[model samples]
Target: MKHSEFDEEFDVIVIGVGAAGAAAALSAHERGASVLVVEKCPPKCAGGNTRVSGSGWFINSSPERAAVFLRALNGSRTVAEDVVQTWASETAKNSDWLADLGATARPTGAYHTEAEFSEVDGADCYAGMNTINGEMGQFLLYEFLVGALAERGIEIRFETRAQELTVVDGTVRGVRVEGPTGEATLGARGGVVLATGGFAANPEMVQDYLPLDEYVLWGSPHSTGDGHRMAQRVGADMWHMGNMMTITGIDVGDTTGLFLALWAGHDYMFIAPDGRRFTDETKGNRHGHVQRNGAEELFPLRPFHIVFDEKLRAAGPLSPTSAVLPVGWKLLMENFVWSTDNSVEVANGQIRRADTLRELAAAIGVDPDTLERSVHDYNAACDVGRDDHFGRDPETLAPVSEGPFYSLRVVPLLGWSDGGPRRDGHSRVLDTRGEVIEGLYAAGEASATYSWTKDGGFHIADALAFGRVSGAHAASRVAS
Candidate 1:
């Protein structure tokens, strides 16, 4: 908590190990620079939300389709033309970088614009998943890259906190770190790359940025805005403060699966607190849906409901990549912390698997007549090839008509911090004036204002590309 003075030197000092951190460390080290990774949390959980995400980063977005996505989501303000063009060109370069490393990145042939696991391509852009080896937001990669760095004798200090940046003159200097015994100053002789994650999970940060009263987090405990706070203390210019996360259907009051089931086959028809349908879910892509100002509609951020029968129940919950029967009962039970069976029960709040239509509707809190009418309309449409209400994926509409219906709650979760310090093509952090902050280089999520179409949907290739850029440029400035 207190700060004195000490100094440690390296070619680069990386603060986090999520996807960008992994790529940054590996790329920085590969170019023959001494690097040190400083982590403030458990090694297994160091990757943050990157571990739980779908892991595919968007690269080489088909321009026509990517443009469509940008327009549809009203995100023309979030990403600029030069940014997109620059990122698109570097797509394959990052792919090459990943392959040369010990990691595997297979083109998934699908572009994801939604939280759901499936991929879709439209006039807006090429969106889909890129398969990675680990679940920690490219967790397998952190394992590979971090281990590789250790092998090269790149020292990493765990349980180490970087509380201050040692800046001298207008140019950058090193940082002050606090460890178990005493404080030490770790200097980045060449450059200091701050990939220290974001503050999405921090209450004050979330409230300051997101403006949410009831909060549920999907990211790691370490993402308490260490990056934003540290940068802010030094008069760093911050932008896009009005933006909050574009989440799926997350139950603000519940905890389980860390809010991932928003699209995980829990398909529940969402209604506002007043209970009415909003949005045509099947009509547009997922990114488009998440970006919608649901508050402008009736629900003011409605929650989702999945009406199913014994058939779908037996069929099970779904995973996008895997073909196993999907974890049905497991999805149900695992929702509640105290449930002995781990199956979601009515007593556990919104999860309902009932024997009759009216009973299920009553338990779910919608007017029985409305639910029945909606179901009848849905079933009729299902028979005649229409969704009339929300236009859900036809393949998913199996008719909640079967006796003993079920409902599971789902919501959009803030997967990771998508907003950070703006950076140039070379990963240099820029102030609000668009001038480069000398000696302050950022990459990965820390410097993440870039060629993106929607929320949390950046291509993994971009992370690698920028990581390489930041490191390559940093290596040049360091003494040989």
Candidate 2:
């Protein structure tokens, strides 16, 4: 713990250049603290989950109402009352805080305005506060934060990965980092903040903690539990390790996954491995959870195929066609645009097509009769103008009868995991015994306060709120 050999030093050291880390760095700098940010990914892949997110930031107009809604959303899984209170109160200041930073807000339609749990008590308190000129699944917010950091001359070490926290007698002293040049120890005079995000891209963590056997990742590839491991190594308590934000998407290879635009129209259906229609595919899927058997639960974990006809294929792009931002990681990172007609996917074998329904079933490795029966039932429901089984909207009951039928394989898309080092309301990392680890802090998805379900903009909201808290505290702390 007494590593006197330090290569560099800063008043505050922030890990991961995402929303939380950027906020922490900026807040620290505002307090006249010399801050350095370490990012695991290169400049091109840097920003963490914030860069790839839908860019929907929010502020709570009423903290009391937000508290009620957050409690309802959390249900049985709850944190300390003080922590929840701070979460609501601080989140309420997000709009004002962003405004102070010279960021302007704009409406982003229903997806950003509406609360994920509309039926919850404080749903009315949810107010969308997207950045001006921002769109769903864009880097405008991240860019804004980065630009602010540059304006302040904050030093950021890209491709530098934090390996471990150097603890000197129960207090974090510095960080041992491995960078492109090699490994070195960097001393933090005030504290270190871990905003390294969640472990969505880590397969082992996913298998051990999450219930999904296989799924496409819709989050940053750099989110491999770096902060989780470092925090745990320093005796940090982990909470909500099993909770996640899940959705459904199609894997188009090369790390490209597309979220189907179910809201676009209903000329297609999701057929499970059993060649049967399971849940209402058109229902508003709340982070992949649905009200089933009187409790919210995840959608069935199984491989699925989007069965559609030539009409839907020719309608337009299968994914969102009008998103100002790229909807998927590969598209955003690699600049791989999805074909307008979806013909490129079919030619690339990402989508299976056949002239006959039986041929389509065979191509997708499902029993022909079962697939045909499932499609027949769906078409019959369309004919009768009602979906008795899944209760899909009667207005979206367009039959998928025109040949040649197409099937695109898809799996659950994990947005992010909200589990890592437990942090107090002030965003200080807490030990296993609920004691603060001095000179150590955490924010964002890695140390999210939400125990169970999270709302639309809660992740970014938490990051900004707690990031500022940690930054201000770290900057004001007495340097040893």
Candidate 3:
């Protein structure tokens, strides 16, 4: 492609302005490559999932041990040994990289430090790094990256969405973008790095790729699988398409169509649509992983409902004023605050209420007799202070026999779907034949390293590590 064919040109073009994209742009610029970043959202909503995430990166003491841990976590769907080693080594430099970009690292709070899989090999190497001053789920870390990019005078075209790659003889050279000014072609002299997050917010893509029968997106609303589609159109091989990181929550359909917390009161119990208790209600799910048949698997998607009574309602709020991660369209972008005492939602008809358990069952469309029997059995167990069915903690065993029952429907809430074009250790997007597609790269959730199980801070750590890899490698490539 000739220079005249594009509206503008740069040595590198980075799509999506999250941790990965910002890292890529900064890395490329540091290497003397002129970089251009294009974000689909306007300046206010530009950070993607990184802004809403806990904003912590993994810090490992030993690369070799980290490799062992990663391999164990991957299980049968293993990443190549070389790629795993590269990831392990590269992640060790995360703190140094952040420091170089003028970021101060501090320990992530206890909330994020809880071990996800302590039994895995090399778990001893695990540590978490976050910005010195910032609240969890706030945009502080993302702000640091964006500030670094700005300090370098790197140009970011807010509201510019990359539609497709401009390919010449199987070599990607530019991006076709749609922006406020309408359609235009922007050339990349080095390479194009795709940092577009995941498909959690795209219902059609979620239905097509994930095995879940029902779910609600809890990631960035703009994460609609743009990078996946673009890469697939260019013949990039995909991986880990079925992998998902999920939490359980209720869909507050009014504000952002994102999720709200299920009942936080101790008196609540989760029941399937049939009104029977399922897993232990108070058990801490490891990103929605629960033990099934002595093996870990995703908490199955089902019509879940929290059955409680007036005792629970009077205890406090069913949902918090803010989301746990506080990312999605509602919390991060729209500033939609949840009710404090569950009164607002109940009055608004989002929560169903009734004068009796049978009436509550009817309101939520469950069999009244089945609900009554389940409650009776549950109350009997509660009275004895022993739950034989799911082994719920005796302290949390509260009877639901109080009058004026309530039921709120909930489902699996996806943090992000980890799947996209397959990329090698160098962050080069590969074709189906495992060969590099020249001038094409992917980083961040677009080509995440996690396949089966993800540890705390893995997503941001991977994004930062591979974002640099993509930028450095792309900068080395000769212009087509």
Candidate 4:
């Protein structure tokens, strides 16, 4: 069981090879450390989540435009100002690094449209991506990054499943990986980095860790939280246990339930536990259909409906083949994206189209009078380019003119959200007692207390950023 003698110890050992792990490994290797990147799946499998998301500098970021975004993200939360500064400073280098590794970063403006940008520095600029399937933006992203690392003389052992960590004297020394040939002891001379992703892939863990239905994660099966479990087993501090995410995608049907085509957006609604409409789809500071049931905030709608007009449907939201998911494609296609068609109404849980507004509300099972009044208020505003109630999309309104209007029930989909285990600006994983867990580092979805989930954009970007920082930091510890 002890392979400290025959074990192939390296200066640094990185687990997982996605965006975070890849960045970490590259940074460590560039620093003159001999590295071993262990991946359970081959190149294709490791592509995981980053392989499919939209193209853009998420969290509404840019070197010139970050301060406001960061402050807005921090809000009342206990975020390290210095860490925000570091993430802003290093993003460009990371961008360039990614470009060098064959990943092309295109620019998508921070605002959805140029109309929303403020004329100020230290502000967030919108930049989007154009990643692809064979484009190395696809499954090949892992392949390209890994190849770049190997060319640098870093040892990459593929098909290696790292099952356990070997700790000595309270610090992690290395890991025990089981490969196809046989089990091998891979020791880390300095430290071990767990860039292994989230528990979205594991239904069991989904039940144990999250409060929502286990169907929230629309990511990879390989991201079954092996790293989370292993880290927790060794007493690694879990900062944002409540911060795990549950994404709501279009529930296609019985067989193909939750079809996640990023290019084909999910125009679904966020309904309350009781069937009722809440927030206007086009309104809100953050932009994910699934998030939380705010305990303190007093809002009329708990779960928001993401309805679209007949005009939206005709736009022909992009398909699964495109690089970007058109934001509302899925809901549009499923008639779940608000419509006035009988066919779509029939398909959406037997929603009925009313010859009159009262009849329509009754068919959908919502408050008939309240629903009619809401419709009247919404239509009056739609005629002009303004939403009086919630200040929704001023320009993108189309009256529910065509009849037998349909509405699908919506509900808040929650991911987990934990509130403790603070870290410094460096993103070091801390212990239960609020001290750094020396030689051990955590990133990606694994460390969430510092995440700027005030909106959906920062959650991912931070995950990617910290993933890199933790990896490089772990590698640095290996040399001394």
Candidate 5:
């Protein structure tokens, strides 16, 4: 499609209005550059996955400790050492930086301590984490950024979608955008920053990159790989195309609903369709792998059952205190109860109830005899205070030999995809041969800076760090 030129020109055009894009716009404006931020979603839903997230930021006491965590997360992957080092050092000072900007942040607890990292084999290290507390933390951060942009006279066009990056003689010129008016091209004198997030919402892109068939999105529905495709058209290189950060234990029926079953702290036993325990149920409710057959065929795991007894059910709800549901969603689901009490869900047919293990297996369409034997073996191990099957902690082990049993059918949930255009320390988009693409920059989930999932706060922290770097670099080019 042909594009008409927009009357106004900008020094930097930042795509998407999430955390990274907001940071980039603010950073560019702070450097005295004319900036325009284009967001596909409306103003109300402008924050994307960043707003809906837990609003945590990972910051280490020192760069040395952070480097250890970074190296551990990028095992066997060839991430640039300078990039990782920059992330480490900048992240160390992020909390102070945010505070200087009037953002409140307090240290909560590290997901992984230095001692814990040493004990777990091949475990991703998580250290020095903080959460933006209070109910308004998420909203406040975005609001502050928006206010900053307005104060600097940087324009943000809402409901405007960036379609393509316009390149003139191998140098990026600007972006083609579709908005309420029409298709128009906005020229950027400095550069364009892509921060459009990932492809979790795009089924075609997810199918091409991810092997799992059945999954639910735990992030913003607007993450449709718009930036990835736009950059690829201009010969940008991509990386970690198969990497995804996933969370499991989502009820198949509740996939579209706001509620999520973060069963990390629960004592439910996960049984495969063949009626045998497959994994440690107490292990963190993230990372599910699709098994490939000998013929190199890939398929999702069969629907599994989360079996719990009356005693464990009486302890508390299957949902954890850390479970993230939108505040508005809580009001909508107020009438609907999701607890391990089994009364409310059983009445709604969301949970199956049985008097015995064999009957429970039959109810879930699994082998009754095999399920019975598996339960017997599991109960025996529980009695001995040991989990030989999956090395589960004995504290979470509970016998499933009660009169009333409950089961919930669950599947994997895709939080977000973390594969996109590759970038360097300066957040400049690079080609396949590792050469920088002129006048093009990428940050946040749009660039594959994070090859593996680290912790809850790492993504947001990385986004802010590189977003500033890219914004500063773009502004410098314009000044020169």
Candidate 6:
């Protein structure tokens, strides 16, 4: 459908009102360019994944340490040397830049401190990283950005979705948008910045790219890969479309409920549908537990269940509310329940319970004999204080022999996709033949910055760093 041209034009048009889009608009406006930020979701749900995230900042005190850590994290699939160097250097100074914008940095727990490198099993990637705790978590950080944008007179049209990029001659001109009113093409003299996030919320994209059976998206529902499809339509190159930062947890039966199963911790054992322990369960909550059996086997642990006795349930909250939620918020406020006791969940059929391992297996639709054998073997390992199959810590090992066993089906909870249109260090989108697409830029998860998983803060850092770069370069073109 052809759309009429917008009456008013701006120097820069930023797509998606997430962290990257917010930063891009702010940066462009700060550089004396009239900016317009368009968001698909309404103002209430505007911040995308950045608002629900833990809002940690992975800052290095020194650029040298930052480079070494990034090099190790991005093993074979390395980013360009100059890009890596720029990211490393800029991330060190990003904390101050963010602080100047009214966001404060602090240590998250104890691990996110400025420390020397120490090797853990799978957690060695975060060496010299710290976190940013706003005055009131991610909410305040997002509020600050929104407030800043409003103060600068940058118009953020909520409920306005960028449909396509409008190009003229060889230069990208602006974006065609569908808003609450109607469809129109908003012209941009500088360029259009795509900060539209990833495709984790799209099931078809997840099935085609990521190796998972049925994944639950824990991030923003607004991220439906709009920017990715739009960029591809313009001959932009893509990379690392298969990589994702995923975590394992039980589905609380609600489609939007992504509760991290505390039972997946050291206290319980994860058994596949065939009733066998696949991977070590002691590693932290962020580690992906989906195992691949062979070249043909994609997801060997689909419909995997966590087995635990009554003791673990009585210990404390089985599944804490998301860190994004404020303290003292009612557990029952949402559609799903979050509590230590599994009785409510069991009664609701979100969690299954049985008097015996055989009965439990039957209830959850797995082979009873195999499930019994798997439990017996795991209990035997607990008795001997040694995990032969998977080297799980002895301290977290607890026998599941007690009656009234409980099991909940768990699946991979996707945080975000680490893939999209490839961009240069200057934040200009590159095409298939490695040529820059003039007047087109991308940042945040919309661009393939961190192809491999690092820590939490790297995403936000990439958005801030490249958002500034993209905004500055785009505005510079307008000035010239």
- Among the numbered candidates, top TM-score falls to 2
lDDT of 1 at 225: 74
Superposition TM-score, candidate 3 onto the true structure? 0.93
Q: What lDDT does each candidate get?
A: 0.56, 0.83, 0.83, 0.53, 0.71, 0.73
Q: Select the stronger candidate by lDDT from 1 and 3.
A: 3
Residues 1-480, candidate 2, lDDT per residue (tens digit)? 323667887889999999899999999999989999999888988998898887666758899998898888899998877778888898888767777888776667645677778788889998764654545666888888898889889988999999999887788978999999999999887899999999988889989898888787777887899999999998999898888877777776644466765544579998888888887777666765777656788663556888999998988877664354454576676665777888998898888999999999889898999999999999999999999998888988999999999999878778888878888877889898999999999999888887887777888888988898998889989443
Poorest lDDT segment (10 consecutive residues) of candidate 5 = 290-299
Q: Count residue pairs with overlapping backbones in model 3.
A: 0
| Cα displacement (Å) at residue 34, model 1 | 2.6
Per-residue lDDT of model 4, residues 87-175, tens digit only = 66565454565666666654444223331223323334544332322132234444566677777877667789889888878887888
**Clash list (residue pairs), candidate 5:** none
The C-alpha local distance difference test score for the whole of candidate 4 amounts to: 0.53
Weakest lDDT window of 10 consecutive positions for candidate 6? 289-298
- Model 3 residue 149 CA deviation (Å) reads 0.9
lDDT of 6 by residue, 176-270 (tens): 99999998888888999999988878878878888877766666776789999999999999987887766655565544446455743455788
Task: Give the lDDT of residue 412 in candidate 1.
Answer: 41
- On lDDT, the stronger of 1 and 5 is 5
How badly does each model clash, as a count of residue pairs? Answer: 49, 1, 0, 34, 0, 0
> Which has the better TM-score: candidate 1, or candidate 3?
3
Residue 289, candidate 5: how far off, in angstroms?
9.4
The per-residue C-alpha lDDT of model 1 at residue 280 equals 46
Query: What's each prediction's TM-score?
Result: 0.77, 0.94, 0.93, 0.73, 0.88, 0.90
Per-residue alpha-carbon lDDT of model 5 for 130-173, expressed as tens digits?
A: 65543323354566667767776878899999998989788887
